[model samples]
Target: MTPQPFVAMKNIEKSFNGVPVLKSVTLEVEEGEIHALLGENGAGKSTLMNILGGVHQPDNGTILINGEEAKMADPRVSQEHGISFIHQELNMVSDLKVYENMFLGSELRNKFGFLAVEEMCRQTHEILAELGVNINPKEYVRNLATSYKQLIEISKALLHKSRLIIMDEPTTSLAEHEVNRLFELMKNLKKTGVSIIYISHKLKEIQAVCDRYTVLRDGQLVKTGMVENEDLETITKMMVGKAISQERFMHEHPFGETAMEVSGLTSTGHFKDIDFTVRKGEIVGFTGLAGDGRTELFESLFGFRKKYAGEVKINGQVVKIDHPRKALQAGIGYVPKDRKENAIIKDLSVIHNMSLSSMGNFERSGFIQDKKEREKFDVYKKALNIKVHNPRITIDKLSGGNQQKVIIAKWLEAETDILIFDNPTQGIDVGAKQEIYQQIIALSRLGKAIIILSSEAPEVLRICHTINVMYHGEITARFTGEGASEEEIMHYATGSKREGIAIG
Candidate 1:
């Protein structure tokens, strides 16, 4: 006879503002198993997880823990029931120390009701050691790297003695080695009978770590089965309801004269002697591991870093870009890496955010042309397939993928000849990524010089015409993207190998 599931969510249904987001979805998690929840953006994955974590209530559903009906009225009750959630944006106070964050709300006290610092540090050290993390328990969280911060989150979950943990995009900020370490720790946790609900867009990682998988599409469960029995393509098809092509997505386009050229672009300790050129109708990609300075280099190029020393030429004419305004005037547009923090204004309406940079063109006799602005936005909305009920609402209410599309629409309306996209598809879903890629290709075809900066080598290989690898602020290798290998790129990115180039 088969054993009962450790946790089961049956016939879950949720609606937002009278619009159904989840429809009769069911999920089951067995003890000591790593189960993956797979889906594209806006497919009801977050809503379902929120219901399990007690952040929201399902309109129609039943939750059972070990065949016993469970009521998750609040987060405290869920925690008491041995459930923990580690969100993508980690929930840790940066000002607090490591041990302080671990025992933030649930503190230890002595018989006299005094704070117990020694006991808390001891427990924190024990948990960190178990996870192969060696650091001072008193270290400030703000000073630590992203991977260490992620480790601290996992340690906190373990400290709660949680039987089940829900990890959302846990490896988004981790490096390759750090991801491997996390997978190892997950295996150890599984052996100890801790169930994990893994959610990520990286299908390769899902296949590597998860034992069982469930795919959700358009608020409905499409399929659930063992990961070992299905291929990545099959799983992707189930999620998006179509087969996605893996070949290069760039279409035939004629390359034009150079649009932007940089020489001796040095930011002193960040990057050194960076030399590259992007031509109109060309797509160039810069890729490296963490701390390789790819993002820093692009930030400087876009005039966000004023201390950088570089000779920049736009359309074969030398220009000085000391501020973002200057970069815009020079016909260079940049889509920053972090959309929520860097690109989107939380309080601004979606239409206003799209027309923010181009407001001058939308002004008529000292009056803003709201209708004209929205008419332009409607064109992009249709072309990009952006889903939004009301354009007057705040941009933050949309999904990450849609928010990114709005940002892209903003830059496209600016009509810049040189465009730089840093981590173009950083937090986006699989289907949205392909759409963005197609948009980039379309921009290139329209005689725009496109530059893509990403850490994922596969992303660059699939869409870029030229790929440059950087290590320690230096360009280590350059591939034509005709037949570039991730292994070769990683070797240079990790500083294991370098190609000597003469500095001018």
Candidate 2:
């Protein structure tokens, strides 16, 4: 006599290589509701979602769709059942055009069976407009920014008439305005009887958009309740098993002489008139909205962009770096964003990836010393709280947070005096994020000069010693991290204010 829920996964059990990832987990989603899946990085959230998306099969479970048992044998079968999964790591093909990537597997066709290019582009334009993104649908995906690519992924999900959409960290690369637009669109979708399984590490965004919450810890469901009834600290405690403080990190140690100084750094279309100095034991952060050129500016400094006008001094001595090798040789290390494409070699073992940048440390007699590498990796593994059953496994087998830890270990092993981290905690959970912040602070305490690039203003405010706000390829404001507020940062980030202070 009672109506059935739209979707249900009852008593799901899964394991990988004898390690239980999900233990008798159960979930239910009503029609047209936004249900948030919350957990720490390795807490089995992805494993559960993968099962629903048909990327993996559960060892034991009953998945019911509208009260009928549904066997999700493959991703295609899941798609047939009106499920759309927007993955955290983007799945876009760089070589394809925007519209082409949008309709890659499900292409529209004319009566003659030829590709309906015009229709596809028009539809792409229509969907992107809903997200306030304007791009040439015929343009190659490689040319677009990460934020635009993220929007395209969301648009792809909307293209399919999915009854339930599973979004994993959908707003990771989006700007403030763009994220607002997405929330609006999600609300509209919910109004049309569509359900969403929202997975995000950002607790505030979950509070903003999700209607209900489910917390998973150590591969088991710990709590499930309405979002309005619980506070963020309570939800965070459920996810991480402790309370996390939002206070700014205190640095009482005095900075040493400038480790890196930039004067009049300019790249024609990327950034202009950039001037800053990072001293030993200093943490400097640059933040802004999407397309603000913060990433490009740092990419140039790291030698990824060769053509730039600047005077760069490392340890008070001028240097020229035109390649990544030269940057490394200059004692400048970079941990780039987009870990899948730039940070990790998926096929390589976890220990090898950790030692990739500093192979010399593990080499003797022209041969790599596996024992030495593993020994060094063990130190970082424990310090970073990396969860890995075996170091011999490929780096791709680790969770995203663990992969990021490996990348950080690679740079630390290199012993670079100057370090740059772009979106360091992009996809990591709150607890893992706190650990990374402490690591960065520890590195600074050890006299390493650190530069961080983040789109989130609050992140910079939390850890950096100095905060620089960028807008339209220019540094619009500079404030001491302790004195800066999110409101003031947004004012400069949006190009509504312009003020600069001398950086020493």
Candidate 3:
């Protein structure tokens, strides 16, 4: 007799607006195992998960749980079936308190049916403590960092006590230590016979924690097997259909005169004494662990934060920019980190979002030129390989990676002389990352100054011509990108070493 898998979806077929998204894809998962769902952006991984999560229904499929056919009619039904989904874009209400967000739909009540605020707070604290996170349960969620918000979302899932949890890009905003703690908790949950369907583009993390793997590409199943049986290159090839090289990018064109230079740029309590120069035709990267203040420094430079003590020289002329409009007027364009919160206007159409920042480019005599706007968008869509069936659809309907591409296109259309991308590929896949890198490189070659801020050292190493490591709100070291190794970068990033030397 054959043992039945815990969950099985056989011959799943789905389409949206007559476009096939999942073509007879099949998947099976066993009890107490971490199953990885791997694929590039717009590869139907999310659509398949949405079907299982009850956000969408498959046109044709049979889902069996514990050898019994089950129908997930809605999100609540999926939760009732012991399934919990933590979506990639966070669902936290910024105005709510930590405990309130944690107990949103499933609030505790006393005998009289009054809200048991104290009891809810206590449970919230306990669950957060389990993840090595400590915060006042009454604190507003908007006051917390993105990393803490992500932890709160995870704790909310644990509160449900679900038999199966689907985590999508769960660690995208977490620090190294936080990621480690979460992995430990995941292993503990597995010991208690809880199953997890993990979806992430970080292949290394998948190899570390996942038991089995499934690959999907272009709305179809391509491979499925044990994680231990395949190397990263082979797995990457399955997801992207090509090899992705991790070598440093070589620049043939020489850097022009300094486009932007900063000295003693200090934002009180955020960053201090940040000094660097970005030349036309050069790509400079700033990298560090969480709380290292690289993001804050760049935010100040981009005029998102006004009260900063600094001297900023653009083309050797000192400029004061205390607002985003001023930053744009100064020929600076910024692609912020959090896409859902900071980058896109969810209700706007994809083409509108692309042209929102540079409305002048699509306007003629105080009127929007629809045909001109679409023609310009079509160029970027093809260049960036954006996977959108119709430009008229709302921006929120696109995948995270594709949303990021749209944001990038928005800046490119703005035609800024200097561009700043903070965590540019935060939720992007390996293949899409390569395309973005090539685009950045091409931009630099055309005499645009580029600044990249990323927590991943390897990312800066792979693309930048100059690298700066930050620790405790200061620049600890600077290295020519080609000569610096990841180990050396980590040494400064971790506050273990400091040096002020220029080398090529």
lDDT of each: 0.86, 0.90, 0.91
In the range 1-504, model 2's lDDT, one tens digit per residue, is: 867878899999999999998999999999999999999888888888889999999999999999999999999999988999998778999999999999998999999999999999999999999999999999999999888999999999999999999998898778889999999999999999999999999899999999999999989999899999999999999999999997898875899999999999999988999999999999999999887989889888988989999899988889998898888888999999877677889899999899987888889999999888888899888877788999999988887767877887787777899999999988888888888899889999999999999988889999999999999899988888878999989888888877565232
Q: Compose the digit string of candidate 1's lDDT tens values, residues 409-474.
A: 887777788999888877677777888898889889899999999989999989998889999999
What is the TM-score of each predicted model, taking all chains together?
Answer: 0.91, 0.96, 0.97
lDDT of 2 at 111: 100
The model with the greater TM-score, 2 or 3, is 3
User: Model 1 segments beyond 4 Å from truth?
Assistant: 94-99, 118-151, 501-504
Q: Rank the candidates by TM-score, best first.
A: 3, 2, 1
Per-candidate RMSD, Å: 2.9, 1.8, 1.3
**Candidate 2 local lDDT, residue 485:** 93
| Backbone steric clashes in candidate 2, count | 0
Model 3, 1-504: lDDT tens per residue?
878888899999999999998999999988899999999988888889899999999999988898999898999988988988988889999999999999998999999999999999999999999999999999999999888999999999999989999999899889999999999999999999899999999999999999999999989999989999999999999999999887777876899999999999998899988788999999999999989998888878878889999799999999998888888888999998887678889999999999998999889899999999999999988877788999999999998878888998898778899999988888888988888898899999999999999989999999999899889899888888877899999888888887664353
